[model samples]
Target: MKLLNLQRRMARAVMTPLTHSERMRTVAPDGRSMRAVASQIIKPNDRLTSFERLEIYNRQYWFRVLSAFAEDFPGVRAVLGGRRFDAMAKAYLIDCPSQSFTLRNLGSRLVSWLQKHPSRAGERQNLAVDMARLEWADIEAFDGLREPSLKPEDLAGVNPAKLRLRSQPYISLLALRYPVDDLLLEVRKDSDDLDVASNAFNERHKRKRVGAVAKLNPSAIFLAVHRLDEDVYFRRLDREEFAILSALQAGKPLSAAIESALRGSLIAVADRAAHVEKWFHTWAALGWFCRLEKSPKNEKAASRQ
Candidate 1:
């Protein structure tokens, strides 16, 4: 019984989420400092000291997480430059240390944090925040659950008035003041010669255009962030489409959501009638929606059968 209890305690210490205070401790309750602990675990052929061995894990941990952040916030990275970007990255990690087992979950809170504390490391904080959101959505769309598409036939003849439709988990709509999307795309296609000044074009100040203005009226965007055939895409949406999807996301019924969308513009009427059909068709073609909810009539029929 004593041996079992000791084994369980050690397991908990290894697997349980460590507190910041706990992490700061060089040694654990097992009388093993990180250096000694790491050295003890090292294979026989390994020649490094416990400190050096542990340093490898520490270095790789920071590297992998930072790289993921950089990939997720390319536009922000462009504006901030390498030196400032790394500083902001370090600050972010320190403030909200990784809580999940996977590194991908590390940046989930970063955008909201940036919005609250924008002046980090001399970066244009709000712009970086927006870019971070865009990038985060990109990461999520790539990694989130993929549902099977609903066939057009499945939705056909179904009363939109009665059905409650849900947007696929992967699609996200974002409204932004700046053209971070276009700028990021341009930078990705172009060479390392992308100048920070060009990226932050100043039309009023007489600077030549590198890409269209990052800022837009209303300072928001309607975007569809989703994956099709294993490739993630960020497609911009018209106001009507955005409204329709937003309502659906809020769990409004299909008829009500369509009606709300129509109030925004007359296109809402046609779009409402055609939107589900078109979207489902494309969704089916792309394999975005994974499961379909059967109507009451179908459920009854299946029950009787």
Candidate 2:
């Protein structure tokens, strides 16, 4: 085989999913004996056969990928029991394998995959989806881009009718059907002690903790996943607050964003002005707003290394 063809064949063999016992299958999907295929590409060492040598690479590839997926979505695993999470993760990865050079994007398609394959999530499908969304948002916020924030002086005298602002690139707005934020934080706090396959920290324990099951009852939850310094945080938002921020992030002017926030608001028109002022003050303090225009004179953006 030419060098490129040989490299492709090796990658295909390594990426082939392992069996339930985490062993390389004896036969490839094309019905070729794995031993024969291995012999063609690998030379046997003193203590190992060609098949055994190839099996090592195959197992390691899957082990790392599975570990990466688990690390990114521990909250989802908590929602779905460990075993089911493993099975669903394997199936999802087989269908949507990592396409990026880094493992950071491995679970990027997971929420959609769960949506399509609801059976994979069992009884708590919505909860699982929400947990996945929140977990993924955490990932996005941690490594997301940062630009110079609009400071108090920068916004001074700016008119809301014409003010054009953008949300910090790292601020992720999420609308969810469950109170998954609590569950996610709880899961992550104790994740280090939980064994993935043995259900060492089983779902039953979750139900007992302050009625975790009841806490997960369907509710409209809006959140902003944002970073301060080096750590990420989940901030609960009022429905109107979520709407206003999302509208602003969509490139709407301050006046129009406020209008969008008012469309379905339950807060009275008289009460809204105070709430709006408070929201803008809080968001501004958090460095959530960025100037839409850029110039060399603009303060240089700081990025996490």
User: What's the CA RMSD for each of the models?
Assistant: 7.3, 5.3
Cα lDDT for residue 92, candidate 2: 95
Best by lDDT: 2
lDDT of 1 by residue, 1-305 (tens): 37787555434334322234323236654565655445455443457565554455555566667788777666676666666788788778767777888878888898788877767834356566667878888888887776666665655555566556666788777877666676666556543434544533432222112213433333666677788777888778767777767887787766788678768585645556676567545645765443447767434433553
* Local accuracy of candidate 2 as per-residue lDDT tens digits, 107-138: 99999999999999978788889889999999
Can you tell me which runs of candidate 1 are displaced by over 4 Å? 1-60, 121-123, 191-218, 266-291, 295-305
Candidate topping TM-score: 2
Model 1's TM-score against the true structure = 0.67
C-alpha local distance difference test of each model: 0.63, 0.84
lDDT of 1 at 265: 81
